[model samples]
Target: MMTLEEFKEKNYGKRGNTERDELEAGYENFKIGALIHDTRLEMGMTRHNLQKK
Candidate 1:
């Protein structure tokens, strides 16, 4: 798995284009959200469970 910095460098740095930059940002956000969801699920934690903390 790519670290966020590596992902950004490959997708949004000097070699990147405007369209790709936007898409990469969105993709990054989606990946973060999915990771959070997956982690929570694995821990048997729901939104409400999280909110209680």
Candidate 2:
């Protein structure tokens, strides 16, 4: 099987391409959201609790 980088290159074009850049930005946003979610869970904060703060 191809690596993730190779798969991205084959399906999305090189890093500088507009589609690739947008995909990368989306992935970064997802990563940030995941990190925040995990942190909130670790802190024993539910969504409602977080919203209160």
On lDDT, the leading prediction is 2
Over 1-53, each residue of candidate 1 has an lDDT whose tens digit, in order, gives 99977776776764367866787689899999999899999999999997897
The alpha-carbon lDDT assigned to residue 9 of candidate 1 equals 72
Clashes of 1: 0
Model 1 segments more than 4 A misplaced = 1-15
lDDT of 1 at 36: 88
* Per-residue lDDT of 6 in model 2: 97
All candidates' TM-scores?
0.62, 0.94
lDDT of 1: 0.82
